[model samples]
Target: MTPHNELRLLPWSGPDGKPCYLSTDTTGGPLSRLADHAESAQLAASTELLEHAREVLVDETSDPEELRLLATDLTCALRDALRVAASRGHRLPETHASGHGGDAGPSLPAAAFG
Candidate 1:
């Protein structure tokens, strides 16, 4: 059986917005392939949305309604991105050559995003 943390965090939710997991060892299965495709689409959409957001921010004539809608879209994209990050993070190997333990790298300070 797969370890709890090793279970794949599926791209979509289950009942009532709860997260779903897959325990199969095989990565090429149908569900896995679907999740992979969904993740790819989500990331691509986020990239496009970011570009549009930059344009909206730069345009002085953007109305309040437009800004509000952009904010909503950005929030959804950010949520998806965070979910993808968490899923990928859980799947990382226990050790790496970086010697910073199993972590990817040093995390940025919270103020960096401010």
Candidate 2:
């Protein structure tokens, strides 16, 4: 049986909107390599966009339109980072507040992807 960590699939897509998944156990497998590269790229973008956000936020002369665009970029960066996180591990179980059952089963390891 596949490990639960490997089974933790993150539903995301490629630049062209093609569906993709990430699994750490693949090791040298094609999908594993692809996901690693994609995650790195996403991290890079997020880092740069974060710097841009700081600049935009502090610049008193920044235009409202430019600020809006920067906000959109930041949101995209955040989404990518979140996808990477989800791909590498399991998600939180549904809580009673969400109308789901409270029995959340076993807890996954902190470094489940590793």
Candidate 3:
């Protein structure tokens, strides 16, 4: 059994935003190391995506197709980022116990912009 302190939880989020920890007790555990490396890559991709968005915004002749592509990429990147945050035990800035917004599958909550 690995000692509790031998494990380090990365910023990576798990199921339902739970923190994912890497057990370092076994000096040569490949899975943990791989997970950490993948997480780092995800973070780097996010940074790159943000910078690209800035460039596109300032460019006057941005292509519509490129914009759509960017939107798709941004959505995936943002979701991953949010999952990492959630895994670190962070709430998603708002409590949406109710539905997301008006006519959003279920009727909107009483407080609109919450």
Error of 2 at 104 (Å): 18
Root-mean-square deviation of each candidate, in angstroms? 4.6, 9.0, 11.3
Across residues 12-82, which tens digit of lDDT does each residue of candidate 2 receive?
Answer: 57698864655455456676666667788889978988987888899999999998899888888888888
Poorest lDDT segment (10 consecutive residues) of candidate 3: 87-96
- Candidate 1 lDDT by residue in tens digits, 8-114: 99888888999999887777789889998999999999999999999999999999999999999999999889889998898776655476555666688999999
Backbone Cα, N, C clashes tallied per candidate: 0, 0, 1
TM-score of each: 0.78, 0.62, 0.53
Q: Please, what is the whole-model Cα lDDT of each candidate in the order they appear? A: 0.87, 0.70, 0.69
How do all the candidates rank in terms of lDDT, highest first?
1, 2, 3
Q: Tens digits of per-residue lDDT for model 3 on 7-79?
A: 5556566788776666554534687566657667888999999999999988989999989999999998987
For model 3 the TM-score comes to 0.53
> What local lDDT score does residue 98 receive in model 3, on the 0 to 100 scale?
42
CA deviation > 4 Å runs, candidate 1: 1-5, 96-114
Which pairs of residues collide in candidate 2?
none
| Position 39, candidate 1: lDDT | 91
Model 2: lowest-lDDT 10 consecutive positions: 90-99
Residue 54, candidate 1: how far off, in angstroms?
A: 0.4
